[model samples]
Target: MDSQEDLKRCPVDFDHESRTHASNWPTEFRELRGKCPVAWTEKHGGYWVATRYQDVVAMAQDDATFSSFKTFDPHSGEVTGGITIPATPIPRGLPVESDRPDWNMFRTYLNRRFAPKAAEARRAKVRKYADSLLNRVIETGEIDLVNEFTGPVPAMTTMELMGLPLEEWREFADPLHEMVFTPKEAPEYPHVIAGVQWIFKRCIETFHQRKTEPLGDDLLSYFAHEKIDGRAVTEEEMLSFCNNIITGGVDTTTALTTHALVYLNEHPEDYRRLQEEPKLLPVAREEFVRFFTPIHGLARNVSRDVEMDGAKMEKGDRVYLAWSAANRDPEVFTDPETVDIARFPNRHIAFGAGMHRCIGSFMARVMFEEMMHVVMVRIPDYRTHPDRARRYTSVGTINGWVDMPTSFTPGPKIETGLVL
Candidate 1:
């Protein structure tokens, strides 16, 4: 709860790091969207929470005014704040942390690797992995959906794409999942940082190895060989690039799928409907992305004074663009709260907007669709244990499940030799 003076300054002062807040942020966001769309808070060294659809889009589109780069200090020209609010312990690099010209340069090179057309080619692999994951648990009749299926699928996908050792998938996924819940000052924070550092060390080693002996056409190879500004990208830049991809690619789709599963399990009719109407899966995927925004909202550093919807934001201040709130805005989607699997023309900001829109969106779509389609068709009657489910403690970066225990009728495994 905020003090009276804080409430006077901004009607709704939110603490995104609060576990209770994260658990029921949707309810809080709904109230904020109606009461005070552009609210401020003293939490995380003070930041604005933009809850309206229009305000979020306006700020997301204006990267120059609301810069994403946070590590670099405007005062002394030295790297200071980490990427997100309640700032991350380590410094992030291009292009998520970079703005405009620099962002475009890095983004342009990586775009080709994640283009929609390029992602389509990975469909077989996606389905193959989905089936393979289900094969291990199909006969078990009980499993933790998040740990067994949702989490590993994308982890394996991203690792394969990065040319990392597949056996080390948990090493990459566990730390990332833990980092989502671990605050900078928490006891587990040091362990989380250590895990990330280990991943970085592995990525740096891969970058060096790929430089010496180029392997398959993977992302690491792109980083190792691709030259920008007439020169190869530095190791630090390469590490940052890898960090962004790993972080973006892993839990987002997992959380989206996890939430979708939890919802579908709760409403068996919707699950049956999706199972029966396979054609609607594509549209359903969009609805799921909109309804269950995996990464709730991201922070932006205000580069200059700006006014939006009668709210004044000062320069150097941080603003949180509530994507989850914007998605549920009644002004945007019809009956935004209700889950409509058939909802079309969904103009959601789940993937963000402007130059910073998620680059792995295409792959995320492919992975999600394949996984959803397979699960619905195969394990349509899967039951999730809500009592045992574990959700992220903070919505600062991701709204995800740490574990979702589920059980379904035992079934046979399909032999799909689509593995490369």
Candidate 2:
């Protein structure tokens, strides 16, 4: 096939119903990378597919040359598009889809919450919650791992971190999951959007409460009081800011936890190794995130006409940083296909890179590490129910298990008395 045809045939477009049912996505990506590193796919209504390690990495890092704000029109083939695939609609928030000074300003206020020390401070509480969830599962013998355990752990952790009422966690988590992994036209979309709106509204109300009462700890209090540009932030900005953190935090962490367990089940030897040498738990969590790449790709729009690898990309072109493809790139990672707990210099862009990198990365790392540690210590022999392994559908921007049925002999729950 000619280069243009080759680009048009790139298989990354899983948006189409036929391609959407794919069971072996990783293999498909590998095939695409080998055949055409920078191929264009007619999927997602036609967009460029960069499958190589270097291409994706460069696209992610070069914010000036590759902007992330263009909105693609599927029907017209217009490339100046939004960050989402299929050129769909979503409630806009600052920084996630913005560029430069504006993005930096918003990010600065939120970055403090996910700082390394702040994230570490939540470990004890996260571990307790993780263990408590597992305790419920251990008694059941067989549990729907995704819906029962993997999903709630992160949802609860995010709530705790945000200092929101735990009672509303399920209400928030269900809709967030639906919004990210299901089609927007689905019946669930309206409900999901409503749930998100409700959460944001509550956040706004809480901001008011915090302003008067001044709760010393938690994110809302910080945002309520924090000054930007030598003045207090506006309520709308605070709501959008909190929405960004909560929305991003809830689903991705759930996906990471689910993917990690699935990986452990698929590789029992690795699970046993982790159980034996608990010190490797942290490394294993990072490797799992890198290998699975819970969030598949992040989109960027080119701000200027740029030349990369002999190809000319025009101004306002939408460039996708394929984190999944990049994570498995052979050039950067030795045997990128294999999940090595000790993979050194393992700088994966799973959380992204540069100015737009995920602010919740440290918290995510802590949640994953603590959850994995608890699982390894308590339920060492957990295995997935092969017949019941439920892979998520319509997850264009994120990859995760929708339903994971795992069977394990839940050991006696250990009491690690650590306060939040």
Best by TM-score: 1
lDDT for each residue of candidate 2 in 266-334, tens digit (9 for 90 to 100): 887877787788887777777888988877776666677666654566665555667888889887889
Candidate 1 residue spans exceeding 4 A from truth: 1-11, 72-83, 183-189, 416-420
Please provide, for model 1 over 1-420, each residue's C-alpha lDDT reduced to its tens digit, 9 standing for 90 to 100. 455344334545588778778878889999998888988887867888898998899989998898887465445655543347767545585578888788888899889889999889888877887898888888888878887788888888888888888778779778877776676788988998899789889888988899987546888888888788789989878877887998888889999999998888888888888778888888988999999888888888888877878777777778888889999999988999989989999999999987899999999999998888888778877889878877777877888888988999989988976321
Model 2 misplacement above 4 A: 1-22, 42-45, 70-82, 410-420
Estimate the overall C-alpha local distance difference test score of candidate 2. 0.71
Question: Model 2 misses residue 337 by how many Å?
Answer: 1.9
* Candidate 2 least-lDDT 10 residues: 13-22
Give Cα distance to truth, residue 158, candidate 1, Å.
0.3
Could you tell me which 10 consecutive residues in candidate 1 have the lowest summed lDDT?
1-10
Give each model a TM-score.
0.92, 0.87
Give the backbone clash total of model 2.
11
